[model samples]
Target chain A: MGAVIYDRVALIGLGLIAGSMGLRMRADGLAGEVVGHARTARTREVALQRGLVDRVCDTAAEAVEGADLVVLCVPVGAMDAVAREIAPHLASGATVSDVGSVKRDVITAVGPHLPDGVHFVPAHPIAGTEHSGPESGFPELFEGRWCLLTPLSDGPEVERLARLWNALGSHVDVMEPDHHDLVLAVTSHAPHLIAYTMVGVADDLRRVTDSEVIKYSAAGFRDFTRIAASDPVMWRDVFLNNKDATLEILGRFTEELFALQRAIRTGDGKMLEDYFTRTRAIRRGILDAGQDVDVPDFGRAVLRKGTAG
Target chain B: MGAVIYDRVALIGLGLIAGSMGLRMRADGLAGEVVGHARTARTREVALQRGLVDRVCDTAAEAVEGADLVVLCVPVGAMDAVAREIAPHLASGATVSDVGSVKRDVITAVGPHLPDGVHFVPAHPIAGTEHSGPESGFPELFEGRWCLLTPLSDGPEVERLARLWNALGSHVDVMEPDHHDLVLAVTSHAPHLIAYTMVGVADDLRRVTDSEVIKYSAAGFRDFTRIAASDPVMWRDVFLNNKDATLEILGRFTEELFALQRAIRTGDGKMLEDYFTRTRAIRRGILDAGQDVDVPDFGRAVLRKGTAG
Candidate 1:
């Protein structure tokens, strides 16, 4: 929308987030040179051919060379290696950040490797889809979404770089790294784990029922399946990276789950009614807060994808 | 599409399902005459205003009189009272059916009171939206959806009625009444209860942090809360009716949930990975089965009412 924020920006891992970053930067005229890197030559070539970046480089170091900003868009597990690889090549005073789902994990994994002169800012853009690869990223992905930046109190330069996200198209929030992880574990990770697990259970039942699972899934199981179809490797990395917070929130979830099980087992209609009534209110609050885009029904939206049944 | 299947079709309650039935019947010329009735006069007025039925009757008895087909379309808990109110007035050769969530309970509640010559067919159309009332109905609601019918085999009349649904939009599947309840409990009722419970837990957390439980519900919580917002009285009746099946399935879900909790607590990334991977296949199967309609995400189909957010 205005002059470029940085003369050159390096995107490590030309996957969904990075490719999307490239698209967004190009659309908004935010970067002079959008350099993308992938370890595999084939992926790097594909990224270049697909016009995902102004330039393609096979190594993170090459991509970061002379770049004013560097963004690590790989899985959280891969952050340290990329950080170390690109650190020496990053321009002096260049700001480095990421689009990792877990903030504290990224800081721990990538922070130590960043050079003193290159500012390191850890951030998480709370948005995505099940699709992956360079083709999946688009400029509009971050519009109106929350981008949380967790910077050390003394790191003013890094904090300023984090504000670039707000300039691009995001509402910025500042939170302690650990708090970010804990809140996400409850809001996103745990819920995903539950959905993935329930879908697996339903699939197992489908086998015994001679394929009735998919047949009748429209009744409920289909929603779980759609979420479960997410990129497995990325989710595995998320759980491994943010172990403690996930475990903490999961404990609370199970305690509540068991109480519900008890209500169902003993036919405590009153408890069920009370619990159900309370939850319905939460949905209303969501609507009032405008956190959720109003969709008539999840199943109906699923139908629109038209990719699946 | 063909000659009207029945000379007269009486819809006992003009809510979503019943109104939908009337629309579908008119669209395909599946009924010779469509009559609507509701417990309250206001609903009848709304039905007539919406042209949901050809004739709006003042009483349930008046609606059922001389109709070749009668459908009881009320909450599962109300099956007994509605059935009794309309039973004596039903024409001798008329076939009576229902669109309830729980099969055994509907059959139990409505079976004994039916006249000797009248055929009783219990059906559950495994489709709905969070919104209720006459305005929620649409002709395409049951398109490509499964309709489960549990009917005694002795009557040719019941078989003819099954043909009627086959002529309409639904794919009809017949099963044992008790087994129907069990299957639905596993696939629908139990999941709805768990969703309601989890949203309740999240709602409690919202109270403490004043967080946006509904607003920022990613995929899992968003989907859960959407299903949880289903009609409270209808869900309560469903739970009361299908207590045994729901409790049995809830037991299985809790056992699985605790194992997952333990996996998270112990930092067993491999176990979590194993479970998450297992679930992705179900999405593929649903996609292959053509049951889950795909949308951008699992956002709901847009509703014209703009009432339920």
Candidate 2:
């Protein structure tokens, strides 16, 4: 624990990311006091019971009343309304940030509603699990992950926010919001959309049957299933907000897929081999870059149990 | 370790699956005096050095001289030549099986060449890692994984092969060759094609550099990279041999992907959320079936290491 970066930090929307932030902030004494607000009273109660927050407020307005830092950790679609409701209650000169995946859209939706003298630095911590809700969070979620801070301008507030994330155990990177979206499209959004599509296709396969697909899924389709199992509403909002970049990446993916399909239909083994070899290099690069350190066989640890059955 | 199922078992290739089979069979004493052969002397030497086989032969014919069971573990494209080379030298009443991802193609390639009194039972083990070669294999590779046997006949020979696989630590399922191909198309082939296409698209992106894609890949693309990193020659053979089924499943995937893309374009959150929710259920079904046991946050274990940078 270090010196408190913010005397009081308010987190709106007590879900996985928000709850994770609360736990991480408290663990490191990044905030003197942590408060939280959720749309439903049940979630607020869960957050309080889980010790994700020191105080649980009934409304976002009340949560931000005396807090030096307020983070909008809700879905992208709900950010505008929350910003409108809490703008009047924000403390003077307080730094306000958001944990939305889409940055340009978030800035567009929430920037105008903020009161004067408040900072609107949008950030995205590229870390999560398939699990959601306040109970799904742990203090170690952000360790060794990259957190992107998309600020319109560089100043003391942005530096402080970066330092706070550093304390939370993330390697912080400052990027333009558009670049962040395009990079995310290439790395996260498009892949997730494709995984969802693949799982949907397998589910809708009449010939193979869903039961067989599920039973034999350990081969390869299981990876797609894991990615597709993420929170539905959060992903829906992500696609709706980051439409342009996601669509563009999807277009490129479609083109590449069609070329491979053609190669397969034509019996062009060399073409397929060349393409596979090239893509294989990217996986090596990811491992070399330390972005992915998972074992080649992910389920080995689980399978190593005494009972093979 | 248990009683030997075969006096001498011949593995006709020295790759991950075959090497793992040798290690596992030796570990459990499933086969007496396991021998192996590969087209390249380098692979033979590696297999011998790694103890993947007791005797590494220079020729497939030499490897199967006195063996009661011969497993063709070469790439799908190479199965025909291997079957031709080893057919004349096989012991009478010996059982022959191949671990090719596509069954119908293997049957077509190797069925006519097998001599009378010899049994041909095609099997496809639903297990592998991105790493290849003899050194990559381990005794536990087949534990808790499925090995699909697509035999043309239901007889004692098929049951023996099933028992052999069971002894090696895999759940065996019997299906018709054509049905196995289609099921694998939905579960393995098409998903692998999509993953390769996604990685290729990211590699070819003009705006997003490869470094950026690799760095931010911990989000979702990392999973695709792992799938796409599989053996290039093996995957090429898979796409080429399983063309019709893979292409059909890919067509369905494209349809589903376009529907989601349109939903994103029109801001149809309901449709997107509904589709994601449905796919999420399939993931749950897969987990419930015990096909996948790892928590969704695969990166956490690696991230927990002391080096945050």
Candidate 3:
């Protein structure tokens, strides 16, 4: 494997992904200089203190100066503003990619802001932790994880950018941005939404179930609580950016859910058993495929059922 | 705490719960002798080999001999046969209790078999793990957990037995049999069914998404997988026995899910965020209440999340 990818790489937004990028780039000798940008002075200070970046710039435009590669690692809602700010200063022939969860919105938000000479690439690494901030990231977050690239054409710049992620210890996959959104909606967004809903239901169960909630959570509901504990702001933007695809999957999910509810009401054990049995196999598939990144909590937000002071 | 709640303890069904009962009884010195009975020859052998019981009996009748406490830890479907098998040999004044997840059916199945002098207490310890076998038990399984006792006021031995679980590291709450079912339906059964359905949906996804299902499962779906990966036969029995309560909760769950699904379909970010925020508080409640046991797998399955291999 190539020990290094970029001589001078810029990481904008010193949150989980950005910090993780800097850590991995440095740990694997993947970059010589990792310059980072953050709007908040405290976060920038903390990012530097945590050794997440080699250089902390005052602005995104300043961070991208003289950079060969720039990875946009910000919330989807902020993509547009950041893109416009950095576009004017991006070096010619530089490759700009992102690490946003929602792809289509990033493309729409950042595409027009790219300068004529700057090469644009959008990527979503299928990796993260529930904990957010520079302090929470580690060097191995991207190791053996999938970093998806949604390139626009057969440009050598795009392929080279894809190869860069591969060098950073990621399995690179290229797909259409819309398809990426659809797939994620089905696999990720919808599940998180349902988890949020389940946690809400448990919360609304009044005081009686309240006392029993945590004690007996081992029965099943604790899983939802873990997922629902995820960062609220990041998720809010994700839902906002990927509304249509999420809605489509949510519709299908509700339809299936209602049918199962009907089966339960009607005492259809066969149906219930069939559904439960089928799901068990899927869990096996995940275990067999080795997709879970050896993390017991699976990067879930499990503050209570997970970990917290 | 009373070290010996009963002079002798008989455990029917040598699975996780039965083994756990023996381990706990021995660890806490809660029993004079622990006798385990299982119909399967191999289970009996395993129980003996693992020291799950002071003595492994060939029959329920032999197991219940000289016992003041008899805990039915068998599946709900097998309750009656075991109850009847032991009824003929149950010592006079002995208190009979159960650790089944569902109470109503257990009352129906084991109630008729109870001798006039034997007390029948239906108890549900709101805790469990995915693993099921003689060796898949631990002494601390019931520590600080909630155990619901469906009391028959007419029975003295049952009330005495209910007090035993309270002393055995469980916070005991007594309620009518039917009422207990309703509470559990919301707290445990419905959540489990939903988890099962979601996992099934993921399993039924296209080959492409299926391949990435476990890979990106850490994002959310892996939690569902963990819950869905519970013992199939035990879960099957829970739904089958607790049909009324499970169905009622299922109705409410679907109604709530529908409202959320509609909001998602219409691109209502406020509704999603509102629900998500509301749920985060419940997890806090569970923690503040001291219910989030810091054991393996949220106190259900062994949680080896990021645990060193």
Q: Candidate 2 chain B, which ten residues in sequence have the lowest lDDT sum?
A: B300-309
* Candidate 2 local lDDT, residue B100: 95
Using lDDT as the measure, the top candidate is 2
- Cα lDDT, model 2, residue B9: 95
lDDT of 2 by residue, B137-182 (tens): 8877777779999888789999999999898888999998888888
Instruction: List CA RMSD, all candidates.
Output: 3.1, 1.9, 3.9
Q: Per model, state how many residue pairs clash.
A: 13, 0, 3
Candidate 3: tens digits of C-alpha lDDT, residues A1-309: 345667789999999888888887776677878999998999999998988898899999999999989999988888999999999898998999999999998999999989888888899988775567777777667766688889776698877787778877688888889988878886678788877876776666766554655555655676567677767767888888898888777767767877877775677767767777677777777666665423323322233434543
Q: What is the lDDT of residue A179 in candidate 3?
A: 83
lDDT value, candidate 2, whole model: 0.88
Predicted structure with the largest TM-score when compared to the true one: 2
Interface RMSD score of each model: 2.9, 2.0, 4.4
Order of quality (TM-score): 2, 1, 3
Model 3 superposed RMSD (Cα)? 3.9
Candidate 2: the clashing residue pairs are: none
Candidate 3 residue lDDT tens string, B137-214: 776676677888887775666556666677667887777888677777766788788777777666666565647666
Stronger candidate by TM-score (1 vs 3): 1
CA lDDT, candidate 3, residue B99? 88
Worst 10 residues of 3 chain A by lDDT: A293-302
